[model samples]
Target: MDKDNDHGKNDGEQRLESGEGDTMRAEGRFIEPQEPRAEPGQSEEQAGTGDHATPERLDHPIIEEPHEKPEKRTTTELLYGVIANPVETLRYVAKHKLVAAGILIYVAVAWIGAFASIPGSLNSFEQIPEISGLPMFSPRSIIVFTIVGTPFFSLLWLVVYAGILHLIASLLKGKGEFPGLVSAVGFASFPMIISTPFSLLDYVMGIGISLYGLISLPFTIWTIVLTIIGVRENYNFSTARAVWTFFIPLIALFLLAILLVIGIIALFVGALSR
Candidate 1:
């Protein structure tokens, strides 16, 4: 009986020990897990599971720097800039040369038509004698007059003429592609069509006495303003510089006219002496 009691006590102690071991194993399983360790040299930021994992703070500040806003340009300032840059104005003209050429062709055709209509009108003035002391009324006379006068008027027209071309090109290319001098020349000449009315009126009223000069004045001023603007744009010049450039072509034109007059006078004298 004593042996049996001792064996039963030993069996109870073994069962108690076994139960304690099982409880410890179950407790270990119930506890939350720790995050796995990252590899060496790997950043915690890259792991994407840090204490600061909220979306608002998740984006790394180092990747994005703030940008500055661009300054705005006023219309007056833009106009002034265009005029100061003549080379750019000309370049603008050259780019759209086809359009410019088309306008010139149209003007030429109109002038031709005007000439064609002149003969019937002139018939009302007088009849021709067999051989009058004065030169016969020929269409060539009108043609000669046009050839001589057109260039003078055209030169004056160049002020705005070059400006208009430059303006169009610059505007079309976007403010970024600032035009050159060729563009100014090409584009600006479009408005010279305005001068056609002056010629027609001159023909109808007999040249020197008509309101043609008064009518052309506004166009002349407009062209000058445009040329100045074209120069400013191409060159990126100041307003003062643009204003100054407006006079440069005029001065050049004046000097050229003087030279031409002197050459003509010299040639006339030489011929008279011969």
Candidate 2:
């Protein structure tokens, strides 16, 4: 009767141990066991069944798959892509820092526009009945000034505009660099290229500047929209944040102007009272 109790107690202990081992394995606290091995002078079944048996655990290695690279876009494709897939295209421009290409596109458009305006300017003079001779600011001189000034002013404006947007975006928790944002905003002006043909038509057909202005109005608005998109993508910001970043500088300037006017009016009132 004592022998039976002793055997029963051993069996209960073994069951408890097995249950713990199984729980550990299920919870991933222990690695899975390898093939069971027999002890010296012990049968495989006896070794596997006994408490002294502890099979080795095998550690599996983790393998990571490589990521695919983004496709490279040519300058032409990038310009077209702005219209087709603005988000991805602007992101690529910002990531790649295509500053030169963007600046070139803007400057080229400005130069073309300056030249196109020459025809209209000359035509306007011809329409006036009062003046037989060229005025002090002659058409030729104005043309020369326009052509020479377009490149420098356009390039400077691009840099300054990009800088303002970058600063505003940074204030809004943007993570983009100035050069990247320059490229982004530069590319954002891609939609303005659509007006080139209209300018060309105005130049060749002697259409009034009014026609060009009418045609460019919608495209100008579109360029502003693209600028907002570029800011959003470059800075990884939400649409509202990007819009705020774009407009904040403009709003500040406007408010400053108002304050200056008020100050001037107050000073004039003080002078009048004196």
Candidate 3:
């Protein structure tokens, strides 16, 4: 009996080693093998192999490209940009505070207009030799005067106009610098250049000056519109606010002139009564 018990125990051990015991445990049915599951925050490779991960088996790191900045506009671009696309160009001008470009534009327009009038000026003065012969009235003197005075007055107007706008803008809760406003205002005068060709033609061909004046009116309005746009861009103001900021100074000056005239008339009447 002991021999039979030992033989049975040995047979059971052999069956387990030969995989027969596993099949028997399935109860004559096939069981599918389940894949391993990855833990939370753990990659499949890491979960599958733990510390046995290899560099060649892992994914490559991602690299990002650097962003490029926009290029600056050229002089020719700026010259036509204000007329063609005032909003974007003026915004760029205000941001850069391009004082030199602004001054160049102002000086160029002023000089062109001044040069165009040279012939008309000379012709008008020719009838009066006494006036034309004066050193100041001579052609050379006129050229020199325009050369010197155009830049000076251009710069002066930029400063004065910008100062007035800056003050008004500040009063209206605007946040922009004097230099920026100056640049914007100088560029705003770009539309005035439109009249140069007509002025020259009128002077050279004996065309009526009234025709030039008529053509200039629209350009003047264009300049005023550009000025408003510049003010709006620089000050971060609404259209209504920018318009008000520009016209307020002019309105104040007009009212002041009217009061001065009224006071003068009142004094004149009192003196006459006496």
Which of the numbered candidates is closest to the native, going by highest TM-score? 3
- Candidate 1 residue lDDT tens string, 1-274: 9999999768656755878545645777323445656556655554546454444565645455568754544423433433465344344443433343433533453455355445433553344543222354455665565666554455445435556444544443423222245445334433445665565554465555236667767766766666555455555556566665556556768999999999999999999999
User: lDDT per residue, candidate 2, 43-129, as tens digits?
Assistant: 665565765333342133345678888778899999889899988899899889998998998888778777766766666766775
Ranking by TM-score: 3, 2, 1
Stretches off by above 4 angstroms in model 3 are: 1-65, 126-135, 138-140, 205-209
Top model number, lDDT:
3
Count of backbone clashes for each model?
A: 43, 0, 0
**Each candidate's TM vs. the true structure?**
0.40, 0.68, 0.72
lDDT of each: 0.52, 0.82, 0.85
Where does the lowest 10-residue lDDT sum fall in candidate 1?
A: 170-179
Q: What lDDT, from 0 to 1, does candidate 3 have?
A: 0.85
Instruction: Give Cα distance to truth, residue 67, candidate 2, Å.
Output: 3.1
- lDDT by residue for model 3 (61-118), tens: 4455778877989878986899788999999999899988888888788888888888
TM-score of model 2 (CA atoms) = 0.68
